[model samples]
Target chain A: MIEVKNVAKKFGRKKVLKGVSFTAEKGQITCLIGINGVGKTTLLKAIMGLTPFDSGEILINGEKIHPGTYEKITFIPDTITMLPNMKIREAFTFMADFYNSWNAERAGELLKFFRLNEDDRISDLSKGNAAKVNLILGLALDVDYVLMDEPFSGIDIFSREQIADVFTSHLIEDRGVIITTHEINDIEHLIDKAVLLDNGVILKEFDTEEIRENEGKSVIDVMREVFQA
Target chain B: MNVKFNNRDPVYVQVIQHFKEQIATGIYEPGQEIPSRRELANQLKINPNTAQRAYKEMEEQGLIFTEGNLPSRITSDEKVFQRVREELILEAVGAFVDSIRTINVPLNEVLQLVEQNYHKKGDSL
Candidate 1:
């Protein structure tokens, strides 16, 4: 389980993640939905300890995680930043060395699941395949938490479904995930909790079913109401 | 299995998840003759390529094995069944965790609830 409390961050004169706070449960897929330029990526980076937050606290498994605890959360940024010339299998080996929780079998299965070749270089892969490689690496990590940024924003439809399947299969028991994405339809069923952000603040955070049953409206409908109102 | 006219995602891959669920719940048994590609595609309103993709995925996963061009049947492989069962169990556990978390139940309470339910079910049995 992970908790972010009163988290605040700023970039130059602009403030992002303005004292935002939320709890993501273990073994649950919690999604972050926000329009462009709303600090979704910044919040994720803060959680990963890749970016410094100005104030507030982050705790994973009740242990306060600061800049020093970056290992606890594995992140796959929207951009594919891995070396362009490394082979697919070599990427796995590199990951295994860096992450204590890397699972080779799971990684291999994911490569097959995504229909990716081990001999392919990261640079030679099309945009979709590179995303697939990022996904494989993120999912195969045995970390307590994963934070993905816009994982499906660029992939084609066919690759998108396969990405969803890979995401679904990577759910480990009691681990947590916070996926930031604009493509909600592709992952609607995969997400149990939704947090909507606007202007660097959480506008709505609720269980998807609670809104559906109590208000007779789906999360997408609620988002429309919030944005429209 | 039609490929060109259908989706590049492949029909057989689609069938893999569906039949895995069916087999997990005993809706489809080993040695059972699955519906033909044409019938399945019509039922699902998908192209034959999708059906083929599903079948091929299931076959590669060892859930089903085809002998010649005859009616494809579910594999009677016990090992495959056990693997599928474990995977389904893991999935069910994940869903259960998601359900509890959505209600904002604390982690300790959830673990206690699972423990209580486990014993209750054991006693009932």
Candidate 2:
């Protein structure tokens, strides 16, 4: 399990994460959900050690996060991280050279599944295809936990559907997933737990299935109640 | 596979309901092989863990059975199939009765509607 306990981060003078804490368990999909400017992305970066936190602890399986921890945790930032000039084939080659955990066979399969051409330039693809490439880059790695920031944001409807469908595929099975998105409807049924963030704090955290079963409420319902008030 | 699930219940529970409905309606024949957990999850666009839970519950209820390492199949036992059909019919009847009660429609009106609509549907079939 990946645990974040009271993690706090500040951007110069403005605070982003104020005592944020949550756990993402292995073999389950945990969603970090909130409206805009709630530090959802910042929190994910803090867990990845890409963005340093001011206070609190971020631990994976009881060990503090370090540089080597990158092998076990894959973080897909909200924006494209690959170089614009790189072609899809070159991007795969780059990843294969850098990350020992990268699986070329899985990357090949995802390339076909996403209907992407290896010769296609990263800068030449549509926004939807670019997001698919971003996802394929992360998913092809054999990691224990994956943290995705706004993966469903600003993409075409068809691409959103395709990305959501991958959550159920064997490509993601038996691994922990932490996804942050304001649009929750696309993955409502796939998420196991939800951590609602607001104003740099975790407002509430609960099992998505438990809310549906016992309260007859969905994640949207809970979000409405929490965010509106 | 494109089953429209209601949001009020756990997704896994709804999956099990869909499977039971398929068996009761003969859409899935007795002893027919069902999709693997991963295949079901991909087809329905749900978490694989949810699919696994649905299959586990169905196994407990004797609705499906796995042989050794083979994929699970709909239960071939005659008694189990008969029970599944009867249970579904009873659930539908119970729901119908409850709805008629809520609107204060008398039993005679509901019976008439059921008889007329039932025959009309059968004729179309």
Candidate 3:
């Protein structure tokens, strides 16, 4: 289980998370949804300890995650294009070295499912293939939590379907995954819980089923109503 | 598997049933690889994630498995396939039974109609 207790973060006069507290239980896929610039990425960074929060505490499995505990979750950043020097194979090695739960078997299985070759450099790959590699690496980790930011930002329709299937097949049953993305149409049925952020605060929080049953709405429909789009 | 995204129902469950029916009818043979999720979603014109969810449902139910570098294939174990096929027939027949019962049709009349249709279908085949 992951917990964010009264978390608050601010920059200059703008407050991003205002005492926001929530729990993402094990074996659940919770989506962190908000429009662009609503601090969805910030919340993910904060949870992963990549960003500093002014106040509030973060916990994984009931233990406080302080300066340490960074390895409990894998963070997939939005702009994940690392230096072009490393080949896709080498990049996987680097990540595997750091993560204790790195499963080479699962990783290789996904790469083949997506038809990605290891010899190709990360920079040499096309946008679609590159995104597939990025998502595969983040998801293949056997850790308790995985956080992804806009995983499908630039992916094409065809690639999206193949990559999404691999993710679902490989997701661990008893772990928490937080994905921040604007692609609600793709993930609405997969998300068990959703947290909608607006102007640096949680505008709405509910089970995905609640929205469907009560409003007969998809995640996109909820965004239209909540964000007034 | 073609999955319909309805607000009140889980899309993955629908996908699982679709695969079960196809497999039972020999549309997809055991050990045969199914279409990549992108292909299925493109054919259906829905979100790829929905297709992914469907595949996940199949794996959890032990009807399929993924081989590295290969597409997902139906499980070859007869026990698993037989169980899933039986479940599918029951679900299918159960729905028909409920509908017929709702209209107050007699059970004996339904059985007689089934016997007539069975021979007629055999002659056509």
> Model 3 in CAPRI terms: which quality?
incorrect
Per-candidate count of clashing residue pairs (backbone under 3 Å): 14, 0, 0
- Model 2 off-target regions past 4 Å? none
Cα displacement (Å) at residue A133, model 3? 1.9
Per-residue lDDT value at A114 in model 3? 88
Full ranking by DockQ: 2, 3, 1
Model 3: share of true interface contacts reproduced: 0.14
Give the lDDT of residue B55 in candidate 3.
87
Question: What's the lDDT for candidate 2?
Answer: 0.89
Residue B35, model 2, lDDT = 97
lDDT of 2 by residue, A1-229 (tens): 9999999989989899899989999999999998979599889888888778899998998899887787888988767789999999999999999999998998898888889999999999999999989988899899999989999889989988888877677445889999998878888888899999998988899998889989999889999999889
- Would you list the clashing residue pairs of candidate 3? none
Model 1 per-residue lDDT at A86: 93
Q: Which candidate order results from sorting by TM-score in descending order?
A: 2, 3, 1
- How many clashing residue pairs are found in candidate 1? 14
The TM-score of the first chain in every model comes to: 0.94, 0.97, 0.91
Task: Evaluate all candidate structures by whole-model CA lDDT and list the values in order.
Answer: 0.75, 0.89, 0.77
Q: What fraction of native interface contacts does model 2 preserve?
A: 0.76
